[model samples]
Target: MSLPHTPLERVTSIKRKLIILIGVAVGATIAVFYVGVKLGAWPGIAGALGGVVALAAVWFLARGLTRPVREMAHAANLITRGDFDVRVSAESRRDEIGALARAFNRMAVELGETDRLRRDLVANVSHELRTPITALQVHLENLVDGVESADPETLQTMLDQTIRLGRLVEQLLDLSRLEAGVVPLDIRSFDVETMLQGAVRESRLVRPGGAIAVRVDPTGLQGVGDAERLHQVIANLVENALRYSPTQSAVEVRATKTHEAVVLEVLDEGPGIAPGDAERVFERFYRSDAARSSEMGGAGLGLAIARWVVDLHGGSIRAEARDPQGCRIVVELPTAIGAA
Candidate 1:
């Protein structure tokens, strides 16, 4: 219904400004020729009309050529203003600007994702802190009001909550130091099965009567890293598996040595990660579909720390959907030099 404007004209870009400027100049020249034609200069008027048509073509070409750059600048401004959702399409272009535009879009997506994760972190942390603090507060209040007898069991429950809060804070601090590169790794060659068994022991100690198992292949495999830290990684994963799994279900840890690396897996019979959520499980404060109540869910720092530990050892870690039902988290670490 309306033919006055083109898509290029709708956007405020450098190219659009050039089109307007050139159009104004060409329009003025055409106006002068039209006056000459009114004075009986028909030949000049015809030449002026041809020039006007040429200028319009130039404007259209300019718009087409500079549109991606305009989109790039616009997207940059939006990102600087804390908006990361804007994107520029550069898929078909083969120019340098096209590559830059594609890079810009990638940055925007990563930033948007980071922002969303930050929001979730705040929310989850608030909930985690509130749960333990509220419990402690209630226990103290009961004592103050003399509403309940100050039994040893009540005292012990309050103390346990206090310890849990302290542990969460400590884990947060540890993660921060790790990310800041303040925590150094003590790499050493040792049997990784020791770490695996330690983690299983920890899981059973914390959850008595829980089904936990470990299987190591080909006698054993030597792993190189901070055995203590690797121990922490295995424990974190095993604990998480135990947390999500049904009480009587078995949680298994398996380690197999390949030619160049050793692969470790933690398998649980919990509701598996939904499609596409496998990688995100390593993100801080990110809980899968498994019910992460205050009593069961940790501070959400364990997997994040585990990821860092694996990365430091030149390893890769990921979660996969298990067969039938549940999730399997796998970690692969390079074998230590000269390690058996």
Candidate 2:
């Protein structure tokens, strides 16, 4: 008996394959025995010939069942050696081996993505840390060598760089804690309008001339969750808006209540995010404009932190393009009853 090397056999169900294998082996044995006996060969010789014929039939008929398993073993070895690009031919088989191959492909994709993110994180962190450190070092060197005097202006510039470095480090730590779930939420019901107002006031204090505004529809709306964390989310959004907005343009913070959730929005009169980057902007260390953000002392973690906080509170956040030119970020949090 001969096995046909065709894809149809691979797509056939394993049960059918097994049935065919047993049928072929038994039929081949009987045929060989009958031919040997009709040719006047000894009974023992005929039986031995029948056994050899049966073994050959079984081996040929079973290759399809074992080929995929062999391929998977080889692929697994490659994966262990850090070769995520290796893949087995699933051949569209409707069997367990096919399913396993598909799942293995998915896992390889995920592992490759995770490795890429890890590498990006390391590189971005190093770059972020170096910028401020280099600036501070240059300033200190100038002062020590008498290249520049330790006047109030020079000292203030040095202090600003130091503060930026400290802020970046603190944000990194906060993000780490949030991702690890080590920071517990202080969940409770609080006034959404008041919180928005406080965030606006704080932004106002930080940039006295920035145009920031807050509005709550059906005023005195309340929300359920960690007040402080929610405040951080709002503050980060407002600050992000202000950073890109034109000096004379307003950054509007709005809150409205719906049947399902409490919706908060921040709108800015700045260049809007491109459609492709709307989602990626929330990724850690991902900046739409790296040079501009660095000049603004942004370590590209504000939106990332805000996303983490919103996620922890069982909320959703997204970026939108404001009409006539600008950007809007929307956050929706579970209401008290919904949260419960």
Candidate 3:
């Protein structure tokens, strides 16, 4: 049943309001008892009737104070059943219950966001796997039905698809390990120039004709971190740049040392990321240009993995708009005090 509205509802502090209601109920009871005795009623009967009057007054006056707690209890039960959308209407009050209600709402919002990410993860992984699996299945079916010959060229194409599927699976496992904090970092000083050269060579092999340029300030700049993981970071950055960069346009990779940090950059001359998508581009499977990203066979996990690795090294990474056009991704890692 709904609480009967009382004048004490306007009070902000529940403690003070409850005290006042109790005082009023006691005063009403005493007044009623005195009136009955003045009318020549028996003292015992008058007191009993007065006690009933006090109980009724309390029931009417204090019900509103407990209503919010009841609402929260109901909301909590709903939340336990996976209903993150449930909300209590107690925040409109200026009481302790109101603060609790606001906190509950914030928790609900975070839970909803986490649930959304989980759902998206499953859906995106399925979609990414389906594309390559579908291609392989169609080719194999054609060959089996004698509709097409399994020539050297056809076999190579199927092999490439198989390799792509393997790469995706491997990356997924790598990312899982990275996220689980199980991948041990082998931190040490390494030559930034050598790392860039190796990454560039790999990129060249992947796209033979794409132009990739690298520059390390001071000619032999060094970084203090896990060399292998750092190499993975640069390789992913370079690969992303190569995939999006226009033909004949060079992807620039630069490494420079500051007073306390070693900064790495990759600039690509592709259609730049939208301003609204700058931060979100690092979220797993979140592609700003979904159609183009799918066409380029990007699973959108590279930057997310890079961010995790950089975060593990106590470093920071961000995206920026390059001059005139294009995008620049900057990764900054702290340098050891005395390391080169």
Candidate 4:
């Protein structure tokens, strides 16, 4: 592609044109004065002065148009040098060049955000993968050196660690697919009560001794969504609750109908999220201080995946502090009329 003219070149061209015009007018005026002096006419000098004034007006007009062009070129050069902070302030004009400058500024902002996210992704993924790998290596080394024998419990512990690693990998893959827009939702109408019941039953299996409650309104509430994906969303939330809450503490899964949507909440009697972590908790590989050090069998992508599934169904999910203590995760999906 051909490169466009730089602002400096444009300014130089305008200056050159002004000089040439001035020189031509002066030469013509000299020629006229010489002829007029020979012919005894005095008006030729006045005509030449008028030509000079007209040339000055043209020069000013050229400068007026090129000012923004120069500023835009400088901003472009800064951006080319990887300076995302460069901004063009000439957005007031309605011309094509003004629109181009606005678009360039917007692109720089997006590129900056993408770069930050890329750095965060690399750091978080490295940290997450390192933990499980390091644990597995230590255990294997102990067994090899006879520090710990291959007892049944020791074998089982190794098996659990390996399984945790597999699960983490699987979650990462799922999140990647979700983000890539390759996971299509299988939309259908399903009763919310049945879904919650299944999730609560499954959660009980995971935390056998934990006290859990499932509360749903008698009037059936229904919603349109991908049943499998929605089930995963609920299961992940409940599993998260069970993993964090103190053993024997009550975990509640409740569903209620609002005017336009059905709200399903998973509430746990655990230490609530820290003040600044409520939003970040849903990010992939993010963990609050209380859960970060624990050997929780998750890669911290559960909430992120849940949010994606809910968003696919045009719904919302958020974390809130429960009354007195603990955290409540609320999921809201639009209810289908006359569906049970």
Query: How many residue pairs clash (N, CA or C atoms closer than 3 angstroms) in each of the candidate models, in the order given?
Result: 0, 0, 0, 0
> Ten consecutive residues with minimal summed lDDT in candidate 3?
1-10
lDDT of 1 by residue, 233-262 (tens): 888888888877788888889999888888
**1-340 per-residue lDDT for model 3 (tens digits):** 3334555666878788878888988888898899999999999988988899989888877777878889889989998899989888777667777789889888888998888878988898998899889999999999999998999988998998898889889888988999888987888889999988888787677766467889889898988888888888888888878777677777999999899899999998887777888999898877777435457737788889999999888889999988788889999998962332
What ordering of candidates by lDDT runs from best to worst? 3, 2, 1, 4
User: TM-scores across all candidates?
Assistant: 0.67, 0.87, 0.84, 0.77
Candidate with top lDDT is 3
Model 4 residue 208 CA deviation (Å) reads 3.0
The CA-based lDDT of model 1 is what?
0.78
Model 4: which ten-residue window has the lowest total lDDT?
1-10
In Å, residue 107's CA in model 1 sits off its true spot by 3.0
Write down the RMSD of all candidates, one decimal each: 6.7, 3.5, 3.7, 6.9
lDDT of 2: 0.83
RMSD in angstroms between candidate 4 and the native structure over all alpha carbons: 6.9
Task: For model 2, state the Cα shift of residue 313 in Å.
Answer: 2.9
Where does candidate 3 clash, by residue pair? none
Off by over 4 Å in 3: 1-40, 184-189, 274-276, 288-294, 336-340
Comparing 1 and 2 on TM-score, the stronger one:
2
lDDT of 2 by residue, 112-166 (tens): 7888888888899999899889988998999889999999998898888888899
lDDT of all predictions: 0.78, 0.83, 0.84, 0.77
